[model samples]
Target: MGGKSSAPQVVLADDNSPTPSLPPSTSDDPTTSTASQQTTSTEPSAQLRPSDRTENLATDRTSNPSSSVQNENAAPVHTNQLQLPQGTQSSRRRRREASPANSREAQDRPSFDSLGPQGETTDEPLPKRRRRDHMMRLEGDNSNTNGGPRPFTNGSAADNLTSKSLNGLSKAVPAVNGSETINGHAKKTDAESSAYFGHDREEVSRLLIQALSDLGYSSSADALVQESGYDLESPTVAAFRNAVLQGEWADAELLLFGDRDGSEDEGTGKNNGQGLVLAEGAQKNDMRFWLRQQKFLELLEARDTGRALMVLRTELTPVYQNVHKLHFLSSLIMCPSTEELMIKAEWDGAHGQSRHILLSELSKCLSPSLMVPEHRLAVLLDQVKQSRIANCLYHNTEVSSSLYSDHRCDRENFPLEVAAELHQHTSEIWFIAFSHDGTRLVSCGAEGTALIWDMQTLQVIHTLSHTLPEHTQGVCFASWSPDDSMLITCSMDRYARLWDTETGQILRQLSRFEEPVSSCAWAPDGQSFVTGCLYKERNLCQWNLNGEMVYDWGRPHRIQAIALSNDGSLLVATDTENHLHVYNFTTRELEYEMDFKVRLTSVSFTKDSNYILISKIDGEIRLFSIENRKSIRTFAGQKPGKFVIRSVFGGADESFVISGSDDGYVFIWHKENGSIVEKLEGHRPGCCNSVSWNPKNPRMFATAGDDQRVRIWCNQTASAPVLHRRHRSTLSGPGPV
Candidate 1:
């Protein structure tokens, strides 16, 4: 369906006609003269005009009236009012050719060519235009002049800028200050601030989950495991743990060994459910013995003496080779009642309930990856809290939560308050020492009595005194041998005696020295010991286990304190003349000697034997590198003088130094930096003669003082504000000048 359209009409103007003549221009300017002559001829110029279609297109583009027009043969024109494509001439060229010299438009017109390529007639300078286009690309604006997409150089530039700004703002903000402040409120430099806090989230979560499950908070632990996405506990192990908790001994054993068959006899070793098939040879034997032993204990608790005897004779007796453990179990069989059995076995509870503790202990035999620890989260948290208390310097409160983790503890758990204030000693207790096993504690006092305490009961088990045919004067120091079977005590009467810990009898008496033995230390090997005298002769002597003197070194000044290294390779001794000497004990040669202005009260070597710690009368404790012969660090705050204030390295890695002060306070300092961690207050207003950290229990330590009481310091339950007592003497005197 097409309709014929009429042909468009076209009109043409004559181009060869004579132009009208005009008067000559009077202007002297060549530009004006040339323009006037061109207009006077009255003939049409050769310059081309836009076609009617182009004029119509320009008119229709009224919204963007300044847009450049495209011509067929010439470059696109650019003007102050319109932007054009690159390689185009300015619109000034068209205006100058179209207007007469004598007209007002001609007088105002400018020639762009004469002004060079950087002409004022252009929309913008070439450099500025290029910069604007570049910024647009960075902003992700890809549209071009022709309404087409253009490629971008950096699409993420804006995002990068935003991130940098946010980072700068976060760093500019100051950290909070006050009680909630951490890291000791110490200002950190840029380098320190940039350090990464290398915390493993998965490992922490796993430990927390294990801790929670062990503490009987199964629901909480389950919830945590679900939220943390950490599947640390296996269903098999969970079933085994549940069986143990429910007192299903046989079922628990089957789960541990992955043996579901329960066809084995109860007491015969012929079939014991294959006994943890995955366990190694030695470990499997140990596990089988432990499991059978536990079964025997359960039978005895149930009053099935017949079955218990069968288990002891056939199952347990054949595999359980530990003589002491076998004897203990055999003795349990003779208990007249469950109460007697519980008492003899040291059970925490009665009968069935007590079996839980046994089962818990046996659980330790399993690999940690296979079973949750028998200890509760609360207990493990208590240990962590206690460790922080022991390691922290300047800790003022009676109890504190761990600064590194969420573990918390009270005094009852570790014993911040005196659990048992020993009044057995008639005079001030001079020294207190815990046996290596932590089962017994020995305290010597000015009353010439040495009391041995049962740590479990906190009761005096034995009262060793001059009445026992030992020393005539008060005992000055006491130390337990490495084996914890024997004890050595030195007295003001100039004798050092070795005593049998179990029988509370004197084994042997050391030969009398010219002066009182002020200090004594047991060698790590347990076969030898060292002693320092207080006055005349000033002898440092090494004695054998039988109390026979083996080696002796004479000194001009009285020995104030002495220590034997853990390996027994080095001996450190401080004298009254403020001199510290280190000796290679095996070679019997002096390694180094250091002199101080103030008298050195005590000296001890680090566990590694690389450094020596010296306590001075000037209220200072100094750490010196043995090889470098230079002071590594200095600790202050405790008022030391007029008494031998022994400072000891303690904590998990010997990371802290604990010492007693004359102001009746116990001070703990960080060994590396010498920062005061905690200042404990429990003793009465006098000197805390000595402080001893329990070798077996890092959380438990004892401080004896002039208060005539041995105060057991542990983690207190209450977070009571520690009463910080300022020693006026410490402030008034010059410390180490």
Candidate 2:
């Protein structure tokens, strides 16, 4: 229907309507009306309005005499029925008449579809009780037709509306209540979680205690132990430590040995008679000796020379069986003043400030399994932190700070800028050498100048030049004597001269060569040295301290580089013929020879004298084993032969090979694995020709470049910080080759 039907139907009574009379019982029974018939319509029914259609269906049922009995028993139809306006009825009638069977079904059923538009229905059956109850709810009248609510004749609009309202109310009510309940539950959960963690407080306390001890915070550790009800040291150990700290040497010894007589065992006959027996063990003997030695030093510090000699003879002499120990103790008597004694012993200060250190050393003699060390936990944790820092591949820091829970090695600090620059060289520096004592450094350059630097001050203490007849052209190479008192420099001027480092005076001059001296090295024995000549005469000459040539090998190829073994028994040399030759100086014969195929720029020996480091012009550095005569490893990341780039072993236990790059960078590679570890970029505009690691300090190194600058790299967080002036100026020039 175009609009809802206004016509009324005879069905259930409204309050204002009169009650309908019941029909008399019939002989024939009516079949149950199928809900499916509601949607089917006849042509005559569609031509009329909804009220007219309802009346037509009822009249058709009553007129048929065969169905009259069934019609009388059927329930009365509701006024609510599918209604169509007059305009749509004609078109609908044409479609309905086309389907006669559907029209007949519509005439047979009551019109419950009057409630709303007839929606499509599925073939599935609905449960009797659920359907009946649901229909009763939608009817708005609770009165039952036959003992219970009537079953729905067809799916109704009221049923869908009631179901949706019920569902929406059910969802909305719980959602509001659930939010409030969840918030209250969360508060209770947090309270319970806090209580649970309270039980772990003791473990947290223990960890804090451990951290304090490891960091050498003794005062803090003691206070924490008292507050936390924990004991880290036994009473005897505490007493002994206190005694050592207070410089009560005799009391410390008594505590160590459990003896009342401090001197009776040594036959001095002095005793306190407290009846304490001395602990007897080999370790106790060493502890007793250490105590007596410390006491002797105290006497020396007090200028009680006569009593110190007595203690040395009566107590220390019997215990100090090692010759070195005896000599060290005996030398203390010769010191005329306490200041000199402190200096000689390398003590930190006077007045027994280092007594605790002495005690720490003495405790090491005792068996660790039976005795707790003074700072055992602290030392172990410190070691772990250091080891982690040394091996860290990333996130490394210069200092161990609170930023990292575990110590980190900050890689950014590396390839670090120079802490100090040696500026005396007026031209490009060619080579650098450090003395065996690590107290001095010598550098030679193309400016015909050779300068000696005091390692402590970073200042030039001496300079050797052409004015002294050492070189007429630029000095190209330099080496230090093993004793550190004499230095030798070779120049393009064709002569190699030795100079006294103290006076900067020429000690001796070797006979002038036909060609320039290219390279030189001092033998480990300090008796002789070797020089390699360039161009004119391809000879490797060995000379003694008297400026006399002891041995000379004239090879067919030009000698480029040479190195002497630590024992001075073997010499390894590289030549222009692409061959590496090893000779025994004692036997005066070539021990071995190997062909490299490429030009060799430099050669060096490992500290153990078992392997050789060979730098080649092919942009590679190879480690060759002397025993196996085979290549062990190859390090890359640096292009060789832009200048004579020298590479050497460094880092912990010589685990890294460090070299200068032609690209203005210093490259470090793991010696064992040959992996690039660092590419330090500080040298600018030209190649870094040489790098030298300080023999005394593993973390400090120096690099020189064609820029006429000598840069010193030091770890700022190291124990002994280096002194330097920051230079922001750049030098522009070509460096020496």
For candidate 2, write residues 1-737 as lDDT tens digits. Answer: 23545433322212112222222111011231222112111111122233343344345444422211213224433212222111100101010001123223324533334333233222432222222223222222222222211212111111110111211222111111112111001111233223235443333444566578778887897777665443443334455667767767766664454322234443321112211122233344566787777788888888889998999889888866888977887897898887889999776543555776776776565434223455555566677775665566542234454524765555544435456766778788878777767777888788888888777766778889854454348887888888888888888888899999889999998888888888888988788899998763636988999999887787665788889888777899888889999998688799899999998888888888989899987779999998799999999867555467788876545666888877778888767668888778747668887888777666667888777778777665541344422222332222322
What shift in Å separates residue 707 of candidate 1 from its native position after superposition? 1.7
Evaluated with lDDT, which candidate comes out highest? Answer: 2
- Give candidates' CA RMSD values in order: 29.6, 34.2
Alpha carbon deviation, residue 200, candidate 1 (Å): 19
Runs in model 1 lying further than 4 Å from the true structure: 1-415, 467-472, 535-538, 717-737
TM-score of each: 0.44, 0.44
Output the lDDT of residue 570, model 1. 85
The residue pairs found clashing in candidate 2 are 1-83, 1-84, 80-114, 81-114, 82-114, 396-409, 396-410, 397-409, 397-410, 706-735
Q: Mind sharing the TM-score for model 2?
A: 0.44
